[model samples]
Target: MVTLFDLIVSGFVALVVLPLAVSSLVAGSPPPPPNMFLAKYYLAEPRLMLASNLFLLAVCATAIQRLATHFGVLSEPVSRSLDIWISVPFVVLLLAFLGLFIKAILTVRRANRAA
Candidate 1:
């Protein structure tokens, strides 16, 4: 179980660090075709893939922080069950969003190529 301090520290690092790491990873990839790829995300006016990664990472980090801190306050089965309840949904949401996003990108790429 994570302590409040551990949650805070790890969550902060996750919010700040993972996004930077993901940004670097995306930066190394070939740029998306104009705005088409990113437009499907949120507001969608215009933004970098790094922005999306940062946004998603921020959400996960916040949820993780909350979960960890909450877990620290509980005991035994309660803590463990709470941890599972909190973490599982967040993870599922994250995976769902990521899969959809990747699928959209590939669809766009294929269309762009076929055109």
Candidate 2:
């Protein structure tokens, strides 16, 4: 009962997301080319690229977990365990990002008010 959407998502994860995650984990971030305008930022903050790649991997993993559950590939208890483990970190990260975003906005507003 695989739908077109399922096939597309699985294909994207297998072909693109998985490879990018594996490469970033194994090789770390690659050095940006000298001619590239963003090379300075890349070199200055390599961890940002790694963190983003890991976040992408986490999202793909969560998608795959949901797909597996939908297909009955995972049992109830095991699926619940995986869900808890995978989802907790993802939720925490999401909240952390949201907090940072709000903090940034408030900081900017305060600065504007002061000026």
Candidate 3:
């Protein structure tokens, strides 16, 4: 049941993320293709992939903490540490995503100008 629920959640997230990603890529390109292969290249781009994974990791950590809390497994200290761990990755991923977005924007601008 849990596995099925997780699969559903993941599919929902993918449905959201992939279209947003494809649209971003398409908008950036002047002569965009009808369909971009975002999934094929998502993991191939190291900086973007790392940023995405870091964000996902932070989310998963929070979810796990919540589950643990529901099961009465989280003490005060454990909860505090989990929050710290979650925040660190969240901040790091935020910065990484910002940097990568800026870099991509610059690259796209350069391409537009060159064209």
In the range 1-83, model 1's lDDT, one tens digit per residue, is 45678667776666776766576556753345656635544322223444445445655555565554565654557655766
**Stretch of 10 with least lDDT, candidate 3:** 37-46
lDDT of 2 at 72: 89
| Tens digit per residue, CA lDDT, model 3, 26-115 | 554232233665432333333665565556656556666655654578876888788897888778888887787566666666766899
Q: How many backbone collisions does model 2 have?
A: 0
Per model, state how many residue pairs clash.
0, 0, 0
- Name the 10 consecutive residues with the lowest summed lDDT in model 2: 39-48
lDDT-based ranking, best first? 2, 3, 1
Which candidate has the top score in lDDT? Answer: 2
> What TM value does model 3 have?
0.57
Candidate 2 residue lDDT tens string, 32-103: 587887554445444545555667777778878867777788877898899889987788766654554455
- Please, what is the whole-model Cα lDDT of each candidate in the order they appear? 0.58, 0.69, 0.60
TM-score of each: 0.42, 0.60, 0.57
Prediction 3 global C-alpha lDDT: 0.60
Residue 5 of candidate 2: its Cα lDDT? 92
lDDT preference between candidates 2 and 3, better one: 2
RMSD to true structure for each model, in Å:
8.4, 5.5, 9.1
Off by over 4 Å in 1: 1-8, 11-72
